[model samples]
Target: MSQTINYQAQSPTHEIESKPFDEKNQVEHVNDVSAAKELSNFKMDAMEAEKAEHNMTVLEAVKAYPWACFWAFVMSFTIIMESYDVFLIGNFLALDEFKRQFGILDHNTGKLVIAAKWQSALQMAGQLGALIGVFLAGPLTSKIGYRWATIVALIAMNATIFVMYFADSLPIFFVAQLLEGLPWGIFIANAPAYCSEIVPIKLRAPATQVLQMFWAIGSIIVGAVTYHYNPMSGKKAYRIPIALQWMFPTPLLVLMFLAPESPWWLVRKGRLEEAAKSVNRLGRKSRLNANEIVAMMRRVVENEKEGSISYLELFKMPDLRRTLIVSGVYAAQNLTGNLIANQAVYFFQQAGMSDQTAFALGLITSALQMIFVMLSWILTSYYGRRPIYIWGTAFNTVMLFALGIAASVGKSNAASQAQASFGLIVSVMFTFAAAPVGYAIIGETGSIRLRPLTTGFGRAVYYIVEIPCIFLASYMLNPTGANLGGKCGYVWGGTATVCLILAYFFLPEMKGRSYRELDILFHRRVPARQFSKTVIGPEEDE
Candidate 1:
């Protein structure tokens, strides 16, 4: 048989390898080069697809989800209107027409002072409302959901804007303003929370900063419109700007219907499937698989479990206590004289500018502010939160100090133009540095689990400080002119200086840390000054 076999037809190795198996069962190894080539092609395809879907242009994404952009715009628009309303009053009140209409030109000094004080007083009421509203927002949202809470706040605030038209007496306007204050706090507390929570993390900074821009935009529009319309005509000329306020929020309310509830909130309520769908809508829908979605919910649920709903529990846990403190510090960031800056029209008049020049200057200042804020938004990602916080506050402190001296001496100097010009330059710089960082720090300092609570606490601090500052500023400027601004400059300058010390010593670089990681980092026992390095991943935090 061996002699007859055609041994040349097959190798002994091949024959041995195939001996145990049938023809159909014979195995073949794939070429290593070919297999690797196939895998590389597949990976490239996946990355390309991901980039296409996830890296959407802002315009394209807006078209796909108009509500997202619409809500963002509305939030921004409202702030603009607020700025316009506040600043316009200063210019109008300083005008001869406004004083004459009220029949007090002869002894207008007292009336003018009272008007400023009254406005500031109303602002104080609103600030008080803000403090209370922010403290209450967390529980209210938990009970009523963010959408409803937003609607309620908007309604209350906007309604007051409408009522301001009918306010004939100072007392009536005062009551209306106080009512208006309540909703302003609610809006401040909830809107950012809503906007920040819903937008995908990658776009968080821009979205929130855009809200700040809208506020600036509102200020600009208000300045321009009021310059032309002169809201103090005493014959309903003011209706146009005031009416615009009511008009802007109308569509915003409808847009909320399209906005899905927060997935974290949904999960907190135990609607796991709905939470997945909500998160998917915010994300590139196709990329998130069931397992990934479930994993996200599970982590959120675990965090919530670790963080109870009770306000009492907030102080009980070391992490929560740290979170509260960080958020409280964040609130003080707003206190660095930006709101007072917004009332620049009034201050300019006090600095001895004519009514028209004050309004025009207000416009110029606001436009510059808007430009700086946009720039800050870009730089925050490039430069990180710490650099902005440090440089911004430091520069602002210098400006505030310079402003105080300029305001103090300008009236007698005949170089009032130069002094006023220099002071204005410093203010512009302060606004430039503070605006973007103001919006950025709201979310950065706290854990993911503590976002709502901390945001509420921060806002509460904002309005609380805000109201008193406005009234004090009004009283100082109205009664004492240069002396008050000088003192304010000194006080605010010192405050900014304190902020600088805090920024260098305590404020951690929260620029790039993940929500989970921020949670762990803030919980460390190290002093806030050393937090930058002592935390396990200082570099990672940025």
Candidate 2:
């Protein structure tokens, strides 16, 4: 625990001259009184809370102070990297010669190959590593705190990236992947929750979207790099890009230590004075009061007492259980064909395009994905979650269905070429609609008490499902198979379309509400999705 020093406001040292008794001095005194009132208002928590109650705009708060923009920018480095990691594999795999050289060749014909089962086994191993790391997030945040937890995850992830460059065989490569996955998971789940807690409530949703925007930008940049460089061309092959991934986490490790622990987390741990000091530093205003600090502390403490702290207890309550289940269902977003479309650049090659050409196409598709993600960020607060969730999923499903139909009917050399181009466009549409909003929906589905647990569970489930889905797509699209690429695209598109339709009816709209309000939602007697439109009594609303 940080030691807290008592704060005392400093006064001017010089004594006033006798001439201060004049009318000029009287005017100065009135001005001083007005300044004090303004400072007092700035320190008042109730006034800020009231502003939120009236639905105070995020733009108004950010405009009132520009430094919030700096923090948003700094935070973007971590999230953009998260976005990059999510999609980097897509372009890298698209390199045709790269896959051939790596020994992932025609069925039973490769020299340096790990069996498909082993490749997928490696994927599962990586997912398991992530699950274990995610399980530690809350307690680690509680112990050394959020900033340090971020630093630890950063260091571990970057180190794993460096080690990855040395791997020559499947086992060594798989181990590196497993190690890398551990901390990337930590960065993904904790970074948003950390950013959300530190900023003003009004800026919370936008800040989350800002993080998402960085993610989109990062993905686009990586896609562009791999596309243009054609990472598989020379002797360097995939090694150069694989080594470059480490660069994302290296600088962030140093920056994490410079940042402060979350004030909300500190306050919940009975370190109110330290929380106040941290909050004051974050706001860059030295005059924040102890009373205002105490109010925020009290709110977190009340939540800590009432909510589940253990992983088991998180699943015990009916409402919390439903919330977890609802959140987990969106795990399908990660599992359903989106990732296969996003990550299967190599498989697309079997469909017909050359590796370099496939990556060039991927570069265009990723740009579209980024643009739509930016649009989702802007509309999330204004249009609300339910409509976006419904439409985004619905539209993505339609695109997937089209891709499936196009692939199913196409067969010869010319027809296969046409279907490949058509499938690529439809896949881009799927990513634009589904890939960006997946995190937003997860971010909104639960209260702080159950938030980390639910996120961890959902992420674990996503990866678990992803391991099989990825390899299955790879297997079906193996270069030796007849109508290779067409078959995999058809299967993935059809399955994902079904999962998305189910989600439209089940996912709740979490737009424009406080974290505290989410508890009331899960605790309600009605079904989880209905909570979006149902009005509660005044006492229940409280």
Candidate 3:
């Protein structure tokens, strides 16, 4: 059985005059104290109401929000398109046919080899365009809404894929890669923000985790396709994978028209009625009170207006701390040696493995990553965010350092090969748990009005870090360059250790908080450790 209490009617702001504890009134006084305590508990319940129904379990929340889950799953395909190209380009770099078309002859080894500069350029071009797109996401999403922004991005992305498919020279390929990155940046910036806005607090982590899971799924598809097409010569082998990019965005574009606009975005734009309707659509069968949810959203929007929505505000007082934490978390993701996983096919090939063996290992890594991402969704829901993040960071640091040492010992040695392979697999598995959670955290940390801008800014910082990291990774791994191979892990490992310490001290637990409650907590300057236990009442001053 369930009961509903009207805590809103018993406003905590009402005052009770202090009276002397008299023997005649002692029983009444005791009753008064008990009632006050119960009221306090009720106030806490009201604050958490936005997070979930008064007493609903996570399973119940899922059963209630099937449409929300479906929407999240559909939006996640954008990540698949992004992930496909990430693995596709790396695998192509190691392909015999791709090498024959693009590589210069290395007389010493009597084999065609792509130069380190070209390889680095290929990866960095996308990052450069992604940086630009991230900066543009704020205005794009703000103007047209996430749905239309994504649709426009998809249209542009498909156009670029055609260019990439027909590209013959390195310069043309670079241009195509840069062009492809524009939409990817927009999708990455907006998709998780959309997921955060539409789903219940309990489901946010899982929904965003699904976004990352698709990334691994894309990698798996590319790995398998590239391996199967290994025997083909010239453009045919690489063209097939390049053409596959068209599959994701075309259907996603049409689906966006059917999707509802983000309720938060509507509220920010002063479309209150539309926002309420969006909320009802998203929370159709849920226990959530749509009117109450809209009211909460309105309160946050009104509060946000007190502080203007400017980029400079992101660095001002209360928002500054959040901006730093979110940006740093995104940067920390890159420092986990994920680039090595991104370039796994090439890394294995450079270490003297056959093309088939290298692609097979890449496929295995992606499969393991997909499995771990699903596991992370469950773990994130049960264990909360900070502990899992800390644990994953610690594990990544140790594995990277170990792999670096193994690579430094001797690349061709059987012992080194086994150690490096083991290190790559284990490090990636650990990384899946923490790395993707950063997106959910970034989405949750911002004020409702600034959500898109905050995520876009965070992603811009992400690409700023990624651009140099990708270039450095290509330099160290490309056979024509420094060829550090597994030793590159040592670089990222040292940085991951620093990120681990920062996360422990700064990343607040935001597992079950609504966007409105998060604004209050951040405004109040609550300590990270106390976020989960601290009870906030409506009348409490910010």
Candidate 4:
């Protein structure tokens, strides 16, 4: 990527203009060494740099850009706390002290518990807040840049933690969660895009997948922490875990200040000098040619410079398809039944397991999810996203169906065990394929011009989908409600089946392709299945 060359296609007389040039000539010189005279006389210096980066082996790219990889991982740490907070509230409902503080007496179950309506309300409160946060993240990060935007969010998240820690009632806790969602939204939506930008093309998927790993890691910690505190009888039980959440942002905050800024974001703003410096910091070891790489980024920025920069643009032409694809990718995870698996502690408790077993199973399930997410790094590399995502959805369909069958076998211990086992299996399949892949795709799918904003719109779709699912789960799991237990599997199973069909028709393979290649393919409106075989350039390099 460091090498520079002269473009014989002499267009020195052509005035500099910011418009989407002919896509046909975009890659003409990139991989061609023949006498195919380049088009328009415009030098392919930028395309050449990008081609070099794209042609790199995974190992070559990693060794060359170690600091970029390091910062990507570090920036993703914010997700750990975000995940922790998400699970903490659901599990807390099962704690003795939490029940006393927030639960209403349930005559049917003859026990104290948070009402189903309240449970769904609490979950939605956070989702509503996150939706608002996602809306802000795109513009906020765009204007201020990732580093400062993150600093602002971390500080805001810490401030919200105080409210969660001191809350003595359900209403107060609800407000706290709702408020906390603002920053959590910022972190979740922006983290993947930031990570995607810092790493080289070969490492992009793996880097974005790290966000899911951190999410599983966060869930595991919350499970262990919540399980250990399950024996407590007072407010300390819940407060201690909430207090630990405050610690996540501090270390992440420090790392944010210390990490290199995203070179892509810098280039988008026409700040080449800053972008070059950022690139040098990220890949100094490999001797990255900042001038060439910056030009490469500039071309990408130039091509996407069409349309006024606004959310409305996201719904227009090429970007609309990009928007729908990303939105579908995000929504697919929820359809696969993450809401239940994510809160296995609460899901298990309602399914007839004792509190201790419920917590233990939740921990084990979370640990398994983490392990599978680790496995995803390998699967994604070999199988690419299209197959893994489709296969995972198919597997989800079967496992959720089996879970429903087990639940319908009646309330026997064996039936309960069968339901629990299937839930774990479903979670395993999800993390290995559906769950992790969504994070990666969100990073890769959108146009660079409006990535964060598009991601926000996509996440908004997720919360919109989840809102109905939350209400459904509340009705199904609530003792005062249907108390369907594992029978709820039928609902998610149906959703997974729908998602599978949709993915088959819509999802495309983007395994080793660069953004420029992808841009050409999408512009031509190629078939989704033809993505891998339909070559863009005449002699596109491997």
Best by lDDT: 4
Worst 10 residues of 4 by lDDT: 1-10
Models 1 onward score TM values of 0.79, 0.80, 0.89, 0.91
lDDT of 3 by residue, 23-94 (tens): 449978889999999766545544555545424567877777777788888888898887888788888788
- In candidate 2, residue 115 scores what lDDT? 43
Candidate 3 has its poorest 10 consecutive residues by lDDT at: 12-21
Clashes of each: 3, 2, 0, 1
What number of backbone clashes does candidate 2 have, counting pairs of residues 3 or more apart or in separate chains? 2
lDDT, model 2: 0.60
Q: In candidate 1, what are the lDDT values of residues 432-485, reduced to their tens digit?
A: 555556566675454445556766777766666666677667776765333364
| Best model number under TM-score | 4
**Better by TM-score, candidate 3 or 1:** 3
At residue 261, give the lDDT of candidate 4.
80
lDDT of 2 by residue, 166-275 (tens): 87666676787678777866766676666666666555655655655675577677777677566446636667767677667767777667776667677667787787
Instruction: Please estimate how well model 3 matches the true structure, expressed as its whole-model Cα lDDT.
Output: 0.80
Q: How does candidate 3 fare on TM-score?
A: 0.89
Checking candidate 1 for backbone clashes, the offending pairs are: 80-218, 126-181, 505-529
Off by over 4 Å in 3: 1-54, 411-413, 538-541
Can you give the lDDT of residue 52 in candidate 1? Answer: 38
